[model samples]
Target chain A: MNSSSSGNVGIVIVSHSPKIAEGAADMVRQMVGNAVPLAWTGGDIDGGLGTNVAGILEAIETAWSPAGVAVLVDLGGAETNSEMAVEMLPEDRRARVVVCNAPVVEGAVIAATESSGGSPLAAVKRSAEEFYA
Target chain B: MHDAHASRPGETPVPLTASAVLVNKVGLHARPSIKLTQCAKGFTAKIELALAADGPWTDAKSPVKVMRVKAPQGATLHFRVAGPDGKAALAAVLALVHDGFGEV
Candidate 1:
């Protein structure tokens, strides 16, 4: 099931600060190149420091891959918002997504690298979660 | 202690082993640890790495265990690999370490 150019898994990063999310995405890109799909969203719709369900949903769509998608977020509220965004997706798509419990930056980089190697959603999530281990 | 030349008829030879000092400034940090783990996963050998000469060995495929070594710069890392591809795996890991994980 080829999706993007690389046909590997994708990653979505969510953070309370736009800069933090963008920075983490950039780090992932630097480490993994363009072989993996990567998208990120942060800050509220009004440009404040907070999470937005709509922005996260759009990011997930932007980085969507038939292989699957792993969402990494910063803090509990961001995680909550990310879960809500995933729930808003269609059942078929939602089932293919996972909200990883890992550090945002480290998880993004590790997930992207594993995904670039054509790992499945579960493997990618495990790699990211191992960041805490 | 057993004689170095002594060997049983069906016993497998001892594992191939090597040691190298971590020259990278950050030692086995997150990025380098990930790289090492990924490389180790490529081989079917049972690979293990220890921080010191006689330190406890941990599975090289486990990123968490590798990171837990916390080997700083100039710390010697000993590797023991046992399997069909043990020799090749040891060489590959040694090469990566000698290259300073491409950090320098």
Candidate 2:
């Protein structure tokens, strides 16, 4: 749902269920428009109901931005796997990426909204985390 | 002492206020909430939204907080803004709500 929008902070959504990931991405696209780079991933190699580190890494790659990338996960496993994916990033790229402690659906919307507004990675992460505040 | 989080400063001007009915079919749902936050963030004023006039205000620039209000249709939304751009900020948000977020 995003295209031709670069330089803005990117957002990657991770969930155990593929549908949840896609649905959240859809919501983000609808609310934030196509101004922010975005991607979603879930399930394992066989596309079952579980988090996949490789898929998450691919999603991060797809959503990567010079501005930065914020990763939102649905569950503990998703977050853990996303952390592994971030760790897999090149040393220089790792600093530009972060895994947020926020609700997946709501955080994706808030983060994408913040990113669409050209907010930096920290602000977008803070905006998403505010859901818990 | 200067406090950045203070609701009102010692020499602050009185806040501008406005109210609008949530006429959209689904009230302030995700799309509308995001739009409201975007509109509010365009200004430098301190904007807050509440169901009643007295308290329980939430930052209008936060989509999550705005959506959390879950204001169903027909709910009256009260707004308070304080800053040099308070008047324009209040007017913009009120207009967005008055238009029902472009939803008929």
lDDT of 2 by residue, A9-50 (tens): 999999999999999999888777898999999887887899
- Colliding pairs, model 2: none
How does each model score on lDDT? 0.85, 0.89
Query: Looking at candidate 2, what is the lDDT of residue B55?
Result: 61
Q: Candidate 1: which pairs clash?
A: none
> What digit string (tens of lDDT, one per residue) describes model 2 on residues B1-104?
34553545542377788899999999999899999998888888899999999869999988888988999999999999988788888999999999999886
Q: What is the TM-score of each candidate against the true structure?
A: 0.82, 0.87
RMSD, one per candidate, in order: 4.9, 3.4
- Stretches off by above 4 angstroms in model 1 are A1-5, A131-133, B1-14, B53-55
Interface RMSD of 1: 2.8
- Candidate no. 1 TM-score: 0.82
Best TM-score goes to which candidate?
A: 2
Interface RMSD list for the candidates: 2.8, 1.1
- Stretches off by above 4 angstroms in model 2 are A1-6, B1-12
| Residue A83 C-alpha lDDT in model 1 | 98
